[model samples]
Target: MKIRLWLIMAIMLAAIVLAATGCGATTGPSTIVTSQQNTGVWVSGQGKVTAVPDVAILTLGVQVQESSVAQAQSEAAAAMNAVTKALGDKGVAGKDIQTQRFTIYPIMRWDESKLQEVLVGYRVENSITAKIRKVDDTGSVIDAVVTAGGNFTVINGLSFTIDDPTDLLGQARELAMKDARNKASQLASEGGVKLGAPLYINESGGFIPIIQVPIARPGIGTPPS
Candidate 1:
């Protein structure tokens, strides 16, 4: 069986009621209510829906250290090149693989005799983020990169998400609207006032839900998730 992540979401909804005592007026998120309306009712509703994740994003990189910056960078470059090749061979499209970070810095060590920090070596770090459309192949894709990079491979992060949430969002939106209207109807019944159509709809936008699987950096050659 393959690993799967659940995407949970909430949609925002508001129902506006026009008061009969007030003259016709218009404001944000509410339609114009005329003097015939007796009361303004504002209510919020939420909708929750679950979706199965179909996409995986992996953040991995190569880190190497040597006596000089050139040596360190050369080795890192070679390793990164091999890693990218492996990714391509594993069906990852070239466009989906992107470099996220590339850094070169000096390594330091404490020296008692010098009474200061001594320059030990230089390190090169090259990281990339890969978007895997096939969720089931994520583990295999990671394995390929690790094998290609050898000991310099480091896994920074991994997460799962939905590719297209339009359908799910539509479902949530319907549920939310229904919830809002129901609440408004109940309020009107209690207040003994006529219920009116929604004057305003507020949309707060949406975000992709993520499931992060924590994994430690075990270096290349070690098994990856």
Candidate 2:
């Protein structure tokens, strides 16, 4: 009788242990499954917009070649000085006129017969960058530079820019966000999914300078409208 009682106790203990083990396993797996089901899907979208430039910058220079370095440099300097003076006379501030490039290089004459090189003359170049706050005066400034002994070959043309791009960039970002949301909504509708609040938002776009045709002039003329 005692043996049978001990055997019954052992069976009950085994049953209890098995039940506890099954409960622990089920609880952990259920928690993990719930977490996975609650996870959301990620979607992405992009957009772009055009903005008109508000400022114009022009680069102008004078290049002169002469028999000697001194002569070439002197001529280039005089021409550049005349150009700057003309700009100042036309209400360009001293701060706005900046010297961008000044170079003096030897003009090499290659001799094929002797396999030698000779310095025939020297070439001097001086370039100045002018930030014209008034876009209307860009053409006029070029004309003025030409009239002020700025020879034809050295006049590099104008480049357009935005003086303050901060406001425009902000507007662009807002537009981009709107575009992304619209795209997401359309996609969700097509896929038969409810559009949820954005789990993540990533915005990326930049302003690029639009280039205009460079005007070439043998001599100065009326500003382009």
Q: How much does each candidate deviate from the true structure in C-alpha RMSD?
A: 4.8, 23.8
Model 2 spans > 4 angstroms off:
1-52, 111-115, 217-225
Question: lDDT values of the candidates?
Answer: 0.78, 0.58
Tens-digit lDDT track of model 1 for 1-225: 287678787677654353322323443344444642334677777777888888899999999888788888888999999999999998999999999999998888878999999887888899999999889999898889888898999989999988788888888888887887788778767877665456656765465578898877855432111
Q: Looking at model 2, which ten-residue stretch has the lowest summed lDDT?
A: 7-16
The TM-score values for the models, in the order shown, are 0.86, 0.70
Which candidate achieves the best TM-score against the true structure? 1
Residue 97 of model 2 has an lDDT of 82
Backbone clashes counted, model 1: 10
lDDT of 2 by residue, 1-225 (tens): 011100000000010001112122322232223343333333444334454555567777887777788877777778778888888887788888888888888877777887999767877778888877666676677678788964523567666766666665666666656655666556556655555444334444466554453767554211111
Query: Which ten residues in a row are the worst by lDDT in model 1?
Result: 19-28
